[model samples]
Each structure stands twice: as structure tokens, then as C-alpha cells.
Target: MLKDKVVVITGASSGIGLLTARLLSEEGAVPILAARSRQKLAEASSGIAGKHEIKVLDVTREDQVKQMINEIIADHGQIDILLNNAGYGQFESIVDMPSEEFGRMMDVNYMGIVRCTKAVLPHMLGRGSGRIVNVASMAGKIGTAKSTAYTATKHAVLGFSNALRQELRGTGVTVSTVNPGPIDTPFFELADPAGGYTSNVKWLMMKPEYVARKIVRFMDSGKEELNLPLKAAAAMRFYQLCPRLADRLTYRMMNKK
Candidate 1:
């Protein structure tokens, strides 16, 4: 179903987005990679098969996002899918995290999706068909210690995606959110500069390709949500049912950083 479809993925320079691009390209989909780093984007796309394009986009900037989408439409004629997979985590207690850093997280992680989606929605609505896949996190589903800003941003993403899904329900544009547990990616190198979080979850982390494959395979399948590692999802569900106990345990485990 993805064959020859024009799919645009933000954060395509690395991690899940890069892996998804490779998989989609293998399925004959035209992948348009968007990221802030042109050198990294070029390097990442070099090994992917089939036709692909890259756009240097910092999703926080409305003008840049608008320009990238416009250029995409001009080149691809239409966009079939948009994957809002650009985000990062900032692991720190609320009191310790800098206000500006927290704000940047909200800007890049939350507003970034909003900007890109708004830029592409009109085109999708005009065409009367499209797919939007948001790469959310398990933190969005259940709060964890040391993720105050990160969790808030992801929660906003989930809320935004859910509301947008309802608004576009009858418009043929489907929205889906993928909530994956900790993935073994360079994300942590930045999110946890001290390596505490990574060390704590290294054994539990899922590979980027694994998560990416699942997303690329089912993104347009009309599914509303995808949660990784049934075990983690089950635990999160339990947490939702018993917030006090579960949250306390999680806090103790992840607060060491």
C-alpha cells in the first residue's frame, strides 16, 4: 500500500525516523526526509533504496516548515503521509531544569508537530486523503520521574493528535500515535548526558529498526494507537489504574539520574 506514496518524515536524520525512511523506501514509497542537519540527512538517506528527498527543516519555525511543505507539494505533487517524528527528551527534575531549556522542549517537541501538521493539513483536506503518524512516547501515557518537561510535551502531542483525529474523522485523513518504550538510540546521549537513564533502561530498550518497522508497516492501517512491547503497555495500563503505587515505584527506579 505504501508503494510510490509520497511520505514525509520529520527528524529523518537519525533514530526511528531514519529507520522508517529506509523501510518505506524498501516498500517503494517516496520518502521525503526533513531535519535540521543537512549533512546528517544526506548521510542517512545515502543507503536507502528507491527515490527519496531531504529537506532541512527545524519544525519549530513556521516559515521553514511552510516552505518545506510547499517545496514538497511542488516536487511530489501531493503528500500521502506525514510522520511527525521529530522530538527529543530532556531528563531532569523540574526544579533543576532551566526554564529556557524547558521552553525549547515545548517549542520543538510539541509546537513543532503543530506547525508541520497545520502546514500539511490543508493540502491533505483538499486531496481528501492522507495519513498522519505521531511518534509519541510511553512517557506521554504515564508520567515518569526526571521527565517533567519531556512528559508534558509528549502528553500535549497525544492530546493534539487525538483531537485532530476527531476533527478529520470524516475527511479521510487518519491520525495515529505510536507510544514506544525507551528505544536504544542516540536520543538518550542528549536526554541523559550523564548516561544514568540509558544505563537504567539499556536492558529494556528496543532497537530503532524494530520500532520503525512496526510503524512503517501499520501507519496507514487506520489504527488509532500503537504501543510497544505489550509488557510495557500492560504495566502502563496498570499504572493508570493505580497511579499512586505505580508512580512511586517508577519514580524510585528512574530518579537516580
Candidate 2:
């Protein structure tokens, strides 16, 4: 049952992770909020009316990830679910973005998820039960302009989720990926200081609450993957199936904008 389940959520300070934490807490799950900012975590914990824990964790750090998992197991006995939702975007063109910044984007969005997953697996395997819900983006399936680094990182996330799901299949563990479109959250505002926000996302933005509802249901149902905003998912699938046409059409639409 979701009630009392020990769910650890990364990126819980804001956006989708924060929303999910609050929603799950309302549903009776003991949501543990994890992020790099302690103050924000504290504020979020206090604002929420349910029982939850907050931890200052930089997902890109190996030692911190390991320590957090060990600590959670010690306190909670077992981790019922792990939400690898902490991520940032660098919406810079390849020419403008330096190698160091590009690498950091990979470190946070891609390696962050990898490190968090590694830390939780040993504990879950020992108990032979757990769930992992990864927040990927529709960018993973279809590339977007001026977001090469972010897109690549999300694609890596999707690849990792796919492989991990197969490896853990039938082992009393399940992995699911949430591929969401543009969400009307401060995620873009916080991540991109240059206001490099692409024009492509203006019409397609969604609410974090919408995605939170999906996350809760996806966890309960043990869904293999979810491509949210049904129409967007459909279009992306078609793009994957017909890259040439998708490219031409997307380029034309983008040019018109």
C-alpha cells in the first residue's frame, strides 16, 4: 500500500519532484525530500501538512548519494520507492556553450540519476522489493533546438531506464520512466539564467500538478513507462518512426515561428 511507504524523492525543492512529494504525502506515503538546498527543503517540509523528511543532497556526488541511502535504510528499514527527479537544463547552443558547462549538464541530469539509482539498488535488492520512477523528458525521444546537452542527457536517462527495467524485471523490483512535455514550472526559470528558453515550448507547457497525478498513478500501477500529454507522445512516436519527415516538418514549423 502507498500509505506509510518510504519514498525518497530527489529534486524535491521545486518543480515536478516538489509537487510529487506533496501529493504523495497527502496520499499517506512518507515522502522524504532530497535536494542540494537545505533551506528550500526545510521550507517545503514545513509547508506540507504531512509527515516527511528533508535531506540536503547533491545528486551528482557519489559519497552523498551513498550516505543518504545508508541513512535512509537505517532509519526507515527499507526504501519502498526512489524518485530520480533532480535535474537541470542548459539551453545553450553548441557554439555558445563551453565544454565544462556541457559536461556539468551531463553530470547533473544524467549522472545524477545514475548515482542515485546505484545507491538504492543494493538496499532494494537485499530486501527483494522496490520501485524506481525516473523523470525523463519528451526531449529524450525527440531532439530540440538549442538544448543539445540537455537533450542528450535525457536520452541517456531513457536508455538507462530501459536497460534497468529489463535487468530488474521479475526480481521484485520495477522501474518506470515519465516522459513529460514542457511543464509550466519554474524549472526553466531557475535552470536557465540567460533566458535561453526556446520559443518551441510556449504553446505546449503543462502544469506540474498534472504530471504529479501521473507519477502517483504510475507508481501504483507499476507502469513500465509513461509518455504524458497523450497527443505529444503520439507525435513523438511518429517522429521516431519517421525521422526524416519529422525533421522536415519540425524545421518548417520552427522556421515559421
Clashes of each: 0, 0
Return the top candidate by lDDT: 1
Determine which window of 10 residues in candidate 1 has minimal summed lDDT. Answer: 248-257
Give the alpha carbon lDDT tens digit for every residue of 163-237 in model 2. 998999878888999999778777777555544353455667687799899899888997788997877988988
lDDT of each: 0.89, 0.87
In model 1, which runs have C-alpha deviations exceeding 4 angstroms?
A: 254-256
lDDT of 2: 0.87
Candidate 1 lDDT over residue span 1-257, tens digit each? 89999999999999989999999998899999999999998899788867899899999899999999999999879999999999998788888999999899999999999999999999999999999988888888888777889999999999999999999989989999999988988898889888877787777789898998889877757789999966788987888899888877777675655
User: In angstroms, how far off is 19's CA in candidate 2?
Assistant: 1.0
Error of 2 at 116 (Å): 0.9
